[model samples]
Target chain A: MIYLELFLNFIYVGITSFGGGYAALPIIQHTVTKSNEWLTSTEFTDIVTISQMTPGPIGINAATFVGVKTAGVLGGICATLGFVFPACIIVTILAVIYAKYKKSDVMSGMLRGLRPASVGLITSAALSIITVAFFGQELLELTFASVDLIAIVIAVIAFILMKKVKFLSSPIAIIALSGVVGGAAYLIQGALV
Target chain B: MKEKRNYKILLPLFWETFKLSAFTIGGGYVIVPLMKKKFVEKLGWISEEEMLDFVSMAQSCPGAMAVNASLFVGYKMAGFIGQAVSLIATVLPCLILLTAISFVYVAFASNTVVKAVLTGMSAGVAAVMADVVIGMIGKFIKNKDVISVIIAAAAFVCVAIFKVNIIYILAVACILGFIINSRKKGAGK
Candidate 1:
């Protein structure tokens, strides 16, 4: 039941997810963290970090991780199957008849709305991750006193480095460096205090 | 393009997507270009124009774009067998690697140093996401339609402020998108 349940939930994720990449983040957060309580917010953020640093989409990473954690390797495969199942079926169907459906009004029309709407979805995800980066929580429960200034500083510097420095703009490189800098900074601060 | 049913193509398609999934770190946008290079330029399995079709089809369909793109390419090249092979190959890398990480993630996640690294990485994740948002917004503005703009703005408010579920937001956006854009289909010029 657990394997089936994980598979089905991820199938739901696969079906509902559109716009791709960061667009899927909010839905993943909703399914795994909020709706199922399968993962805490921190774990969700951790998965995002892992996905950023490694190859593959966060959906695959989430499904595999949660699957293994819950029920070993089989769970991982089951969840992954769920994650890719809907996409496989849908895209294959499109491939079969695509010569005819190419540029039809319905496809273009849906995309026009969906693409921009994805921007909004990614924006929401960005905000959520930003809040977690700064405050260690999902909700925007911010006060001056409660904020982690070091993390905020790291985020700003990371942003600036990305914008101003051409060599440092690679998202993978900067993210990896930020982890090093953040760890060292926190360690040094702990020593000082 | 001949529709192939040969079992031979199954291996090559699987290998190609396996390489793509193994190297691509940023998902849909990242894997897609490399896929173009490998499938279109190098192997010549699909044409330039056909690759563009695959791109749009992958992006527009529900689910992750990387999986969708690979599936489309696989199915187009061979048949249902190719599709199955490619799907397994594409997902295999992540499943193996991430599951390995998951085994050790609990231990690493509990450590102070690893916690610090993850925390720092989260900051970087946030920054990168913000940059992607800015870039997309600039592109969205140039070819902006009134309805698309309104939908984007409304979706942001609905999710970021009101905390509405994305399922609802996307549903409304799709229906709204279909209704508004469908009406403008006469010339599409």
Candidate 2:
């Protein structure tokens, strides 16, 4: 039943996830965390981080992780397949249609509309991620006191490293560096306490 | 002759897609240049213009860009079977690698250090996500398109503040775009 649920859930993600993988984040968050209650927001954020560090598309990686966590190997396979299925079908149909009507006004118009909307989706995704990363569990309470100063600092440092250093610009490098910094900071704090 | 040619091209097509999927990171846009080099410069399967078209289509469509591009290009070159090969090749490497990582991940799921690292990496992921938003919005602004800017802002508010479903937002935008674009076309004529 969980496997069926995972497949059905990701099928929606696959079809509606316009604008690429990042835009899919909000949809995934909404479906997995809010609707189904399969994962908490914090767990979802961890999956996003892990997905970024891994190869392949972030959306697919996330589907795999969530599937496995929710059910088992079968869930992983089902979710991954569900996530890709709609895109495969739609893109194939689009390719065939586009080949026939290469210069249709409807096509251009749809792209024009979709382009900005995708940007909006991505921006919303960024805001949601920032809120979770900076505020953590306090997101629900909406209090200034809940802000994690250390996490904010790590985020700032990571941003600077990504911008200033060429080698550390890739997401994998940034995540790795941040993990080390976070681990060290936590250890130091633990010792002090 | 066509059947023979398609059979000959399928293995190389699969290999090329596999290589691209294996080596590229960052997902969406990172694969573009590499695909351009391989498809256009190396293999001569498609022209630069066609490649650009594929990239845009890949971006605008659902799923991963790498997979979409590979599938589209494959279909263009060798039809349905080609699309299947490219799609499978594009996903195979990541599927295998991630499946392996999943096992290790579960074993170490309880490690405090691992937990701390994941927590820390979330912040970094947020920063990277921010960059993506900025980079995308910056492009539209640079072009000085007032309508696009407005649409993007409205879309942001609709989702972030109002919690409107994305499907509705897209539907509305598409209608608006269709009306505006068709009018512009008529006016131009």
Candidate 3:
């Protein structure tokens, strides 16, 4: 029954959640933690971390991991399916419809509204994660010394460079360079601490 | 003669687009590098310059980067039908993966080590997301569209300060976009 419930939970999340993995986080947290009682806050937090490391999106990973926990391999499969099936089904239909109406005014109007909303949603999700992960209680107590300030600064600089320079669309370069800088900073911080 | 010649050329492009879409792991900017390697380097379906242009268009357009990319690549390959084929090919993998995975999720999801790794990776996940947004902002600045900049700022405020539901923000942005674009079109006439 728990396993079945978990499957349904993932299906509910997958179908309703419109944006990407990050956007679905709060919803997942609410369902897994608040409503279902399937996972403790700590457990859910760990699930989120593990989901991030896996190959697929967080929502998919969460469903897989959580489903497996409750029922075994079958459960993992169910949850993952429940999560991704919704998006897949929806996107496929949308793709067909969008293709058919590629030139129509209604399509254009809806997209025009959708694009900015996506940007805003993406931005808000980023901010929420930043607030929780970096700027929240523990970091505040440390007075930002142990904070990943270098990462933040590097990110801002990268944004500026990308904005000002037309030649920097190879985001791979920026991600790699930032990773190196961030990794080095963490090592230095660890040694100092 | 033209029909036979076009089919000869178009069929392979459909297969190629399918393969590209199948293996792309993460959505949005995560697949940018992979697409560059495949489309720009391996297949020579498009140039690096063209890929960058596609990225810009994909970002600005409404919908997933993956879908937008398919449209661009498919259109470039064989016009309209290519777009349909690519979109299907790109989307099919997710459907298959989801269908297969749904049956097995409940079992493997409960382990201790798995939980720990997932927790550790959350920080990394956040880092990656931050990286993408920052990179986009840098690119966006070049466009110098005051309206876009303002929209971004207002969106940040609406989300961060007001803590409004995302759907509401999306609705407002859509309405605003329609009005603004319509006004611009009217003025052009």
Comparing to the true complex, what docking class would candidate 1 get?
Answer: acceptable
Give the per-residue lDDT digits (tens) of candidate 3, residues B154-184. Answer: 8778767776665566667767866877877
The local distance difference test score of model 1 is 0.75
Off by over 4 Å in 1: A1-75, A94-100, B1-90, B101-106, B143-145, B185-189
TM-scores for all candidates: the values are 0.66, 0.65, 0.59
Write the residue-wise lDDT of candidate 1 on B1-189 in tens digits: 655378878778888789878756544555544554468756899875466457556766788777787888887777778788888888999999998888677665567786677677767767776776666566568766566567778988997889776667766766776787767665586
The full ranking of all candidates by DockQ, starting with the best, is 1, 2, 3
Tens-place lDDT digits, model 2, residues A43-88:
8887786676555788888888888778877888889889988889
Ranking by TM-score: 1, 2, 3
For candidate 2, the docking band is acceptable
**Local accuracy by lDDT, each model:** 0.75, 0.76, 0.57
Better of 1 and 3 by TM-score: 1
Once model 1 is optimally superposed onto the true structure by TM-score, how far is the C-alpha of residue B99 displaced, in angstroms?
3.3
DockQ of 1: 0.42
